[model samples]
Target chain A: MSDANEAANEPIAVIRTPISLDYHYSAGQSASRFLRAIAQGKLLGQKCPVDGRVYFPSRGACPQHGVTFGDEVVELSDKGTVVTFSIVRVPSENIPLELPYITINVLLDGADTILIHVLDAKLEDVRMGMRVQAVWKPKEEWTTSTANILYFRPIDEPDASYDSYKEHI
Target chain B: MSPTLEKALTAPHKLEYTYKRSLGPVLSPFFTALRDRRILGVKRRDGRVMVPPKEYDPDTSESLDELVEVSDEGVVTSWSWVATPRRQQPLDRPFAYALVKLDGADTAFLHVVDAGDEGNMETGMRVKARWADETTGMITDFVFVPA
Candidate 1:
């Protein structure tokens, strides 16, 4: 072998094989049940009597209260504000949104935590506190999946100001 | 129970991961040196130059300070062999996974080798990197060739 002065160059890599777990483990069917509700154009939120708001894809437990919730399903207003957002450039498995799609944390009316969903409005026009409504696919096209409701976008009318929803963020 | 169920072969289920780690600061220099066909180690608090350069002292947890260059040659300090592999392993064929301590480094590092058969591998045998042609910054980028 040669010294640092004469050694032939070689390369090495630190690869990241990032992974995410899906319902295949313990809750795929449960998640599907929640997804089915969204496809029907209704907003379903789970109530954790003591713990309060947990919306969609089934909130089996209230992380804050640490109590299990078993109650009647209820619907909330579909309208919400973009509490925060991120545009994912990298794609992963099971992601329905295309590149440059807006993934926003929407605080639906009456829910404590925000629900992550695709934003349907154009990237340039998107602003914080902009009021958006969930646009559901036609009744025939609905599926038991969140992708069933295309994405949230600005409602046809006026938008909300930053001050109105700043605290919610 | 049933004839159809009896016909179904049931073998062990397994999930294996052949992780390629980017050694970052400390191990990065060593791997790059390997690609450049050189060997290097980092000098640690105990004055020992550990190969596959460690970034922090295992005992004190302080950042490793200096980079030390070593000979590509080393002795096989320890080893494990795969008679068969599950998935993502470097080779589809049988091979030995060994810990080699290059000449100037005090610690050893892991890599694979096609040392033919189990009878041919020895704890003290010398070896060198059989570097890949289009090397990526990864350990699989090399297979050990007899030195």
Candidate 2:
């Protein structure tokens, strides 16, 4: 390589280009019902006809049994136990949280599957089997999106026994 | 409720990212030349000049480093007309994406030609670089126009 041009001596420019794509997302049958229920401050789950296990925010079918769920909707408690969690230190443009925030896979009561959500608590305090409950935004601010549930916070109850949520992890 | 009768929920989503990248040794100088209204090509082992230069020779896999200045004016070797341009396209109106063999260059490079109408585009038409008002060392610094 020849050092011919004086422009080559200049510092390399770091280009910051923002690319954005806009599109409409359609929430089909089962998800429509789930989103509507959440807007009304309720958690709904569908029971798999074969296994009889309930799935929260159901996608209309059972992955394990390979069968579609019917009208058997189950109302669930917002309180859940953290089956697994991770502390995110890296910054992202979409996430409006501070550094070192905790994200958890929570196993809600009476549901077979887990719901992934943000956990607002001290990093050291976030652990497996930690008892937490959903903190929702005001009623007027409620929308058909999961963003209605701002985040989950720790409750005064004792941590659930490992055996209670062992299978989920 | 029947599945067909139920109105599905729809929401608008925007996926965005601001990618910060360093144009390495080869590309760094290429873009820098564009800022000064200059076009560059890399000299291959056979002395063939490739516009929009690559870091390595495509066929021989040799590391290409000789930067040669090429004329912005070129002849369109091949072209495909776009009836109605979509978002982020070089031209909002109708245009043609052409492989232009710039003067003094051996190979052709793909770029948009803002020819106003598709009928105005041809295989061997002459075109020149239409530089942007503010050049920030980016590929989008210029588009081609009928000269």
Candidate 3:
């Protein structure tokens, strides 16, 4: 709303709407199969033929080219390398994250695009391109979100240099 | 249609968002200042300093770093009357909210103006910040009063 026409402006989008319009309980069907595997102690990603790069958290269509991929739903390695990161000093609501946590964008061995996950390793030693792997909780603690993969950290692979991933930042 | 299928055919829908911001070195200074009870702004190329300062230049995307002080007292740059207030607004009763340029600052911010009735508040009305007795350094800590 404009302060110039401020006095005349009206509030919007507040009312008791109908069942059809009121609450959308679900989206039409999405990547339920990939998500289902996460609950069953596994991680799956889709591979795109056009770019020959695997996508974690499967996209129905290739994000860059828009071609649909169905044949290559495969389990991803627990090991990955941190491509970039940010240390969050403050906490946000319902984030399910511990404060002073570092969120790292990791490029897994099989996938082309990197995915973000919580970093559970020491805060000071955390660096970019440091090799890390998933630390899943005991079988009792799996659920809908990727939080199932407790954290990622350097697993001994040589660190990647800044020149290797300049565009990713 | 049976009553159960009718219920199954319909359910609830919700949209939610969690925006993650990467604080480039410039804006981190601003947020860190907020965490420390101080306010900050960036001096723009056009000589207009902006509050809640942005990291990149408004036009050229240059990294802006000149930090300046802004007074709690400011003029209403622009305003809109809330005849029917919405959820999360400061007041339940009808009110006037305005963008006021603070006394020592070059930019404007939105806040609640405590005018008894909607009829008295005007576009050019002057107001002052009424700080909360208890503050966590968030935007909600201030309510404006008629100056």
Candidate 4:
């Protein structure tokens, strides 16, 4: 650091300005198909030809297979078993939800991959292998966005067997 | 397949930032011209004038000393059409983004032309600077328009 006397001796003009650049991003092929299915209150998954593993919110290509899944998408059930979760108690300005919300990774029925979403259940009530279903918003408000399904909530059924989702965890 | 998903869709995104730049002795006068609604260029030892004047010559790396006034009017050397203007662009409507060689200056300056349509824009077309109502010591203080 320079001394105050040395700083005063140097001659320079400091120009401070603000800049904002706006962009329009295009969601690629696989995500586009997944988002379209979400608008219709449906869930879609894609399977890798090589490993034969199913990925929700289709990635279009499998890194393992090194091949693109062109028009080879599969339908997935909305019901799922929670593999893991974290209770968010810390309040942040960017989080639109209220405090003490539980965010969980659910392994949907017949899906090899897990989907991360907010689960509307009491923090103490949320447990691993808890069965949950998607709660869709009104059809009129549907758009090509995942927001169509508001959030996941527990069904009135018994907890799922750990063996069913242990591999996913 | 849903018709909406048959093709690509665009989503809005914004990046915001503030930048601060320190100007040294050689380039200070160039930006000061923008404040006074004037334009200045630096002359190299070989007598070539560079607009938006640089401190040193590009070829010889010699320190530039002489600053000369260049006419705001210039000829458009090359240009491309912006059918859909992006946010914060100089103009809200269609315009031409061009590299203009200002009069008495050897180098070209990058700016936009407010020509009504692409058909109206052509090579060697004359353009003059359109100053803003209020002056600020920034390159965006003025833009080029058909003269």
Candidate 5:
């Protein structure tokens, strides 16, 4: 063995290994209901009795109200305003989607929480407060997964005013 | 538990972590042998052997590099029966996770013992390495079975 100085430059054998772990997750109360609604081509939101704010992909409990609304589920509209968006151009092996895709965080009608999904439109056409609607997959392809909606696309309506979605941003 | 909540929809989900890691100098040799169906142990200053060898002595700070070959057959020092195996475990059925002392080794290594059921697992029971159909130099390359 050499001294610390010599050891610093010593050749070492390095072994590279790839590790993969798999798990089965239980989608608890709220998530289970939300997924079921997606499977049926509908959007469900849960309201907080204390704040009167509804959350899409219902959080089983309300953080602001500090209460649980097990029986206070509400249906939400598919259309939403894009609170924000980013244009992704860098290609990566890990990402499943195509390059140059637009990712947007949407605040659905009647819901307080934002839903993140890809925007099916050109980067030049997307802007803050842009109204987009969920384009669902064919009925045969419907399942209890967020994949039920292919992507959100621009609707025939005008862009929402910045003040309308400022709180969400 | 709330009684008013309706029955929610359920679906199967698979979770995975995609990554790679490098095993340093000491343990690298141990796993490399596993790829070739062999076992290596590290020798301590007192001459006792440690299987699944570590880079440093647990009792002393001395670096250990003496590699010693040990027989795969070993005795189970302790064990606990798992009735229901979790996902991604070595075996999909029942098995005992045991501390095994291999021949020529002083320390025990934690590994699974495939004894079919808890009734067949006992302290001092002799077991041997049952290699996987395909080896990849990982700790999961083999499990122990009754010798």
Candidate 6:
């Protein structure tokens, strides 16, 4: 026990455990309608009856007024402005992208909320107020998952004015 | 939307964290003993031994270092029957998760017991450790079995 070399030679116990939880996730009424539309290459949002603010991929209720949105579904544009973003340098098993990719919080046009998604562009090219458009996967590969939209990419449109989406950030 | 498609979209999702961690101090030797088909416990201030030893006393928060050997055979103090096993459970078939108080140890250790049937599981039932074919200093190195 007193020998430092002996302690260093001893095998330290290490546990390599991969923990996992598998369950069926039911996307409720609002998300179901949104996913259904997105499968068809359309973005759906719910208009708040009180403030008339549109929530993209709505949670079926307005958080501010706590009012349930009925069939007031509004189609939103795939184009959006990058309000904020981060460069992910670490590798993950789930994300297929290369190292150092940009993940952006986009404020989609006609929607009052932001959608957190990956932006496919050079690291130095991504910026706040940068206009980006959704890049969809092939039609045949579309499913009930938001992953159907591969990622957003910088478009040729002008950068959105700071005052336009200032309240969102 | 069509009535069939209107049903809420449901999909199977699996959340996982795959990582390796070092079993430091007390647990390192405890799990290392399990690899050699032996059970070790920590001696508390009152001399009562705790199986699956902790580095610090739970009540007094005193650092403990005295490691004691305990018998693999023990009595099931309590148990809950698992009629159907989940994907990550130690056993693939039906089993009982029991708190076993090993001989010479005061604290009960939580582990799965393969009693063959739910009807065989009961408080005070004697169980013995069934070692895995290959041991790697992990808790899954052995499971409990009706003695």
lDDT of each: 0.69, 0.88, 0.68, 0.83, 0.84, 0.88
Q: How well does model 2 score by local distance difference test? A: 0.88
**Docking quality band of candidate 3, CAPRI definitions:** incorrect
The complex in candidate 4 yields a DockQ of 0.30
CAPRI tier of model 5: incorrect
Error at A146, model 1, angstroms = 2.7
Best by DockQ: 2
Summarize candidate 1's per-residue lDDT along B72-103 as a digit string, tens digits: 67788888878896555778877899998888
What fraction of native interface contacts is shared by candidate 6? Answer: 0.77
**Which 10-residue window of candidate 4 chain B scores lowest in summed lDDT?**
B1-10
lDDT of 4 by residue, A1-169 (tens): 1121133323325555557787787888778778878888888999988788898888768867788766778899999999999999898644699888999999999899899999999888999999999888999999999888889999988899989888888
lDDT of 5 by residue, A107-154 (tens): 998888899999999879999989999999999999989888889999
**Chain A TM-score of candidate 3 vs. true chain A:** 0.74
Rank all candidate structures by their lDDT, best first, as comma-separated numbers: 2, 6, 5, 4, 1, 3
Chain A TM value for model 5: 0.85
Which fraction of the native contacts appears in each prediction?
0.22, 0.77, 0.14, 0.73, 0.40, 0.77
DockQ of each model vs. true complex:
0.18, 0.54, 0.07, 0.30, 0.21, 0.47
Interface DockQ of candidate 1: 0.18
- Please give, as one word, the docking class of candidate 4: acceptable
Task: Tell me how many clashing residue pairs each candidate has.
Answer: 12, 0, 9, 0, 0, 0
For model 1, state the Cα shift of residue B79 in Å. 1.6
Candidate with better DockQ, 1 vs 2: 2
lDDT (tens digit, per residue) of candidate 6 on A1-169: 1122133335546667677888799997789988888889899998999999989887679999998887768999999999999999999887888889999999999999999999999999999999999999999999877989999999999899999899999
On the 0 to 100 scale, the lDDT of residue A29 in model 4 is 74
C-alpha lDDT (0 to 100) for residue A61 of candidate 6: 90
